[model samples]
Target: MKSCLVVDDSKVIRKVARHILETLDFSVEEAEDGRQALDRCAAQMPDVVLLDWNMPVMGGMEFLRNLRQQDFDTQPKVVFCTTENDVAHIRAALDAGADEFVMKPFDRETLESKLQIVGVA
Candidate 1:
C-alpha cells in the first residue's frame, strides 16, 4: 500500500487525517511537528506529507524551505494542511515547495481532492 506522513502539532488533527488516509488505502505515519517529520523522512520516505503550520519546535514553512534546499530526490509531495488562511502564507508555502494546500476542518472530499491534485488519489 502507498504511504503518507501526517505532520501536525494537534493530536486530534493527526489522528483524524490518518484515519481518512487509511480509509483511502494509504498506509499512514505521523509526526507531531516539523522536526519529527524530518526524522520520519530520514528513516523512511512516505509518498506524501500533510503538514501543519505554526507548530512548536519547528514550523511547517521552515521545514518546507529546508526540504526544498536538500539534495534528496525523495522529498515527499507536500500538502500544507493548516488553519492559516492568509494569502501571503499560502503564497509563501507554495513558493517554499508545497505541492498543494488544504485548510483545517476539511471534509473527506476536500482531502481527496488535494490528494487528487497531487496525483495520489
Candidate 2:
C-alpha cells in the first residue's frame, strides 16, 4: 500500500487526515510537528507528506527546506496543506520543493486531487 505522513499540530486535523488517507488506500502516519515529521521520514520515508504551515517545534517551510536537503532513495512528494492562501506562500512552497498545495479545511476530494496532481494517489 502507499504510505503518507500527515503533519499537523492539531490532533483533530491529524485524525481527520488519517481517516481520509486511509479510505484512499494509503497507509497513514501522523506527526504533531515538523521535527517529528522529519524523524519519521528518516526512519521510513512515506510516498507523500501532508504538511501544515504552523507548528510549535518546527514550521512546514523549515521542514520542507530540510527535507529537500536529505538524501533518500526516492524523495517524498510534499503536499503543503495550510491556511496561508497567498500567492507568495504558494510560490514559496512550490519553490521549497513542495509538489502541490492545498488549503486548510480540506475535504477528501480536495486532498485526493492534490495527491493525484503530485502523482502519489
Candidate 3:
C-alpha cells in the first residue's frame, strides 16, 4: 500500500485527513508538528506528506527546507495543506520543494485532487 504522512497541529484536521487517505487505500500516519513529522520521515519516509503551515514546534516551510536537505533517493511529494492561500505563500511553498498546495477546510475531493496532481493518489 502507498504511505502518507499527515502533519497538522490540529487534531481534527489530522483525523479528517486520515479518514480520507485511508479510504484512498493509503497507509496513513499522523504527526502533530513539523518536528514530529521530521522524525517520522527519518524513521520511515512516506510516499507523500500533507503538511500544515502554522505548526508549533516547526512550521511547514521550515520542515520542507529541512526535509529537502536530507539525502533521500526519492523525496516524498509534499503538499502544503494550510490556510495560507496567498500567491506568495503558494509560490514559496512550491519553491521550497512542495509538489502541490491545498487550502484549509478542504473536503475529500480537494484533498484527493491535490494528491492526484502530485501523482501519489
Candidate 4:
C-alpha cells in the first residue's frame, strides 16, 4: 500500500489528516514539526508528504529545501497542505519541488483531487 507522511504542529490536524489518508487506503504517519518530519522521511520513506507551511521547529520551506537536496530512499512527492493561501507561498512551494499545494480546511474530496493530479491520491 502507498504510505504518506503528514506533518503539522497541531495534534488535531495530524489526526484528521491521518484519518483522511487512511480512509483512502494510504498508510499514514505523522510528525509534529519539520525536524521530526525530516527524521521520519529518512526513516520511513513515505510515498508522499503533506506538509504544513508554518511550525515552531524547522519550518516547511526549510524542510522542502533539505528534501530537495537529499537523495533519499522514497523521494516522496510533497504537497503544501497549510492554511497559507497567499500566491507567493504557493509559488515558493512549487519552486521548491512540491508536486502540489492544498489549502487548509480541505475536505476529503479536495485532498483526493490534488493527490489524483499527482498520481498519488
Could you say which candidate leads in lDDT?
A: 2
lDDT tens per residue, model 3, 1-121: 9999999999999999999999999999999999999999999999999999999989999999999999976789999999999999999999999999998899989999988998988
Q: For each candidate, how many residue pairs have backbone atoms clashing (under 3 Å)? A: 0, 0, 0, 1
Predicted structure 1, TM vs. truth: 0.96
> What local lDDT score does residue 63 receive in model 1, on the 0 to 100 scale?
83
RMSD of each: 0.9, 0.6, 0.7, 0.9
Tens digits of per-residue lDDT for model 1, 1-121: 8789999999999999988998999999999888898888888989999999989999999888877787776778999998899999899999899999999899788999999999888
State how far residue 106 of model 4 sits from its true place (Å): 0.7
Off by over 4 Å in 2: none
The CA root-mean-square deviation of candidate 4, after full C-alpha superposition on the true structure, stands at 0.9
Q: How high is the CA lDDT of each candidate model?
A: 0.90, 0.95, 0.94, 0.91
Which one wins by lDDT: 1 or 3?
Answer: 3
Better of 3 and 4 by TM-score: 3
Model 4 scores a TM of 0.96
Candidate 4 per-residue C-alpha lDDT over 1-121 given as tens digits, one digit per residue, 9 for 90 to 100: 9999999998998998999999999999889899999998888788889999999989999999998899875588999999888899888899999999998898899999999988886
Clashing pairs in 4: 115-121
Alpha carbon lDDT at 85, candidate 1: 93
